[model samples]
Target: MGLEKFGKCLSMAAWMSLLVVYAYAEGSSRKWRNEVLKQVNSKGPYIGLITVFPPEETAFFGTGAFKPSPIHSSLDLSGRRFRIGKVHDKKVIYVRCGVGMVNAAAATQQMVDLFEIVGIIHFGIAGNINASMSIGDITIPKQFAHTGIWDWVNQNGTLDSNDTVAHLDFETYNVPKGGHNILGQIRYIHEEFFSVSGEPNIARPLFWLEVNQEWLHVATKLERMELEQCINKSLCLPKKPKLVVGLRGTTANIFVDNAAYRDFLFHSFHVASTDMESAAVVMTSVSNGIPVIVIRGLSDKAGGQSGQNAIKTFGPLAARNAAKAVLQFLKQLN
Candidate 1:
């Protein structure tokens, strides 16, 4: 054979060998992942049931109809607990994700990583920002955006005239120039999420991470399902609590108690509810390519009321209502 032919043969043989090794590695990785999922799903698919605080979880584990599950707690590595049990004869792994965005996101990531959860159902109490909605009403937002991410733009910056940027001016607070945590203006920014795709996806900064649409469609069954109007005999709400779905929701680390900020969220994003943890949970689940949905009962007006926050009085009741809705959702989830 000519020298060129010999070299070509050698190159072809090396390329073929490389392809075989690559194929075997890819197959093994895929098979291993499949085995992990299969092992977790051996008996049944365990649904991830997550709540924020004690009140939110109390509805499920502390209340009458919903007794404590025979929990098999795990995920000890993160110093968090994941309770495994059967609810309505369905497999569930319940965990309290704690109070803020960090806690919620971390717990959710841990839940997905530790166990092969089929999907996530995050329930909690949230402040109602929609004027039309009332306390005791439950909201199942189609998607949640982490509105907390921001860019504190100086007054001299270009955002003043930039209509594209959703900037919240701190001028209304009247905190004065030298006051603590004073700001000129803040620009809202989208949180960038990592992609499973091998191709570059840097331009995609995600603002709203949505729940599974098919799951949302199943939630339509919950609309007609009746909800409790009052927690007790004397503490009835002004109107019967309604189920409003496909609405917008927002989340932030800050516990919102100001009507102005509440109004800004409503006006800017048309959010029906706002909470501290829902967006983080949703973001983590969606980023992991896991299906997730949020159910939040309105405990208080997101500081829209003139008096003190209504959550103090109605928090438990709202959490209970949300828990009830979560149960109903689970029934329909199958």
Candidate 2:
């Protein structure tokens, strides 16, 4: 064959290869979408919402609440489904991916299927462990600890309930020796919430206090135990999982106010930060291969509100601050 004909044949082969690669990429994306959609759209109504809160009057009714009225409802938008209520934007199809691990995962699956949420910002309230972080400060956790994912993913690749809660973290920040202070990196909201006359009356006496206290205590103890075990066993093992020392708590549970308890976590877990739903969010993202960013406001201090009402006053401020940080984060991604 002439040299010119050979060059043309090679060019044709390269073009064919490019087409094949594009086809495979598109097919893989579609397959992933279908898998996620099948599980989420299996049952019930689908809608998008940005924020969620338990049905409570105190924080819900607090001043400067940007959320819609009635706290929960459904609304129609331009070619999108949205759950009306306290969300980022009624126009943007936001999914109320509920609270806690299981609910969060289920809601997220549904959100992805129905709304096809390209990116998500799990913004809400969180407790502050670092003394420097005042109320209304934002936390963008670089590392998520004590989440149990690493334990379950052994070399064998088998699902084991025997594995403990996986301690996961983000790739954004580095672990500092002698501990790192989480104050200056993220956006800080300096504001206060209004003080209500009485305590938030819970119909069911805060059962979470007891449950959280026990689990909270065990989680810290067990995390330390696991870390120590990993360190001690590291010499004998060829490959060991990475261990991080930081605080990992949720936004919803309010048991974190006890100083002694927070102090216990500080001493035991060596945690520098705290948030409610970040771990669950991280876990879901990790499971689904979705990128997740969690930024929250310091609604309540680690200790009880000295004379101020955080749940009443700071909730809205915290929410707004979190929203701002999320917006900034989204902007930077562009």
Candidate 3:
């Protein structure tokens, strides 16, 4: 064949291959949507209520408040149990997403894919990093950021000035043996999340991921909503618990119990609560275009106290408060 004809044939072959790729992508997207539609027609269009562990579950599910449908009883998938139930006369799909960022993110995405979740309401306990906040208090944060991600520099590596981002110094824990302060510094960093509208597998990096504003507006109705301040009749919080809204919440995989780290978080990020999972849940839901909100009860001060951690004694109380707040917030929704 002539050179011109050969070039034309090659071009046609490339176009055919490109068409195949696009067709596959479209088919895969449609399949996912069709699956969600089928589930909605049969079972759902329900609100997704999520918690982290058993301790958080007791306040919402251990009692009779959640009535699980016999047909959808304990539908287990991906190491999580999704209970289709009713809470305060609103249809809800309740699930415990286990612990940590990975579990939280996986369960959230799974819930969105398997159920037609209109919105997400996640309630749980978190460590207090804000000095003004107290245990058993409920915080409905306006935004969430995954502060767990870090850029660890070498002992001798240079970093940008304070004008950039706050860097954590390890010199406090070390006596300089020589140069480099004996330990490297850590710079808190942002996370990159993919959205549906963005290019495939590419999304902008964000230091703080804002939650849905309409949901935040609805959460304002929870102001002055009562919280549980007592574990029992004798043991109660020194001060009555109050509902605090519009705080900033941060998330990490590591359980926070260090005083210095807590102070850094409070001062740098202005974070009210630090937990293992909130940001993961928020990011996943937002990526899927579903509005999500978090209700966290401050259980401990992230090692701000002098003695044993307060979580053991105050966790139950905090969990109960978060559960109550979630209920009241839901009542205001519809």
Q: Which candidate is the best by lDDT?
A: 3
lDDT of 2 by residue, 209-313 (tens): 111122222223222112111113332222221122233443322336665545544554454555545555554444444455555556666764476545555
Q: How close to the true structure is residue 113 of candidate 2, measured as C-alpha lDDT?
A: 45
TM-scores, all candidates, are 0.81, 0.45, 0.84
The clash number for model 1 is 0
Judged by whole-model lDDT over C-alpha atoms, candidate 3 comes out at 0.85
Question: Residue-pair clashes per candidate, as listed?
Answer: 0, 24, 0
- Which regions of candidate 1 deviate over 4 angstroms? 1-44, 63-75, 160-165, 172-182, 197-203
RMSD of model 1, in Å?
11.0
Per-residue lDDT for 55-158 in model 3, tens only?
Answer: 89987765467777655555666557788777788888889999999999999999998787999998899999988889999999989988878777777778
Greater-lDDT candidate between 1 and 2: 1
Where model 3 places Cα greater than 4 Å from the true spot, the runs are 1-41, 160-164, 172-180
Candidate 1 local Cα displacement, residue 158, angstroms: 2.5
- Ranking of all predicted structures according to TM-score, beginning with the best and ending with the worst: 3, 1, 2
lDDT of 2 at 82: 46
Measured with C-alpha atoms, the lDDT of residue 64 in candidate 2 is 32
Error of 2 at 10 (Å): 78
RMSD for all candidates, in order, please.
11.0, 22.1, 9.1
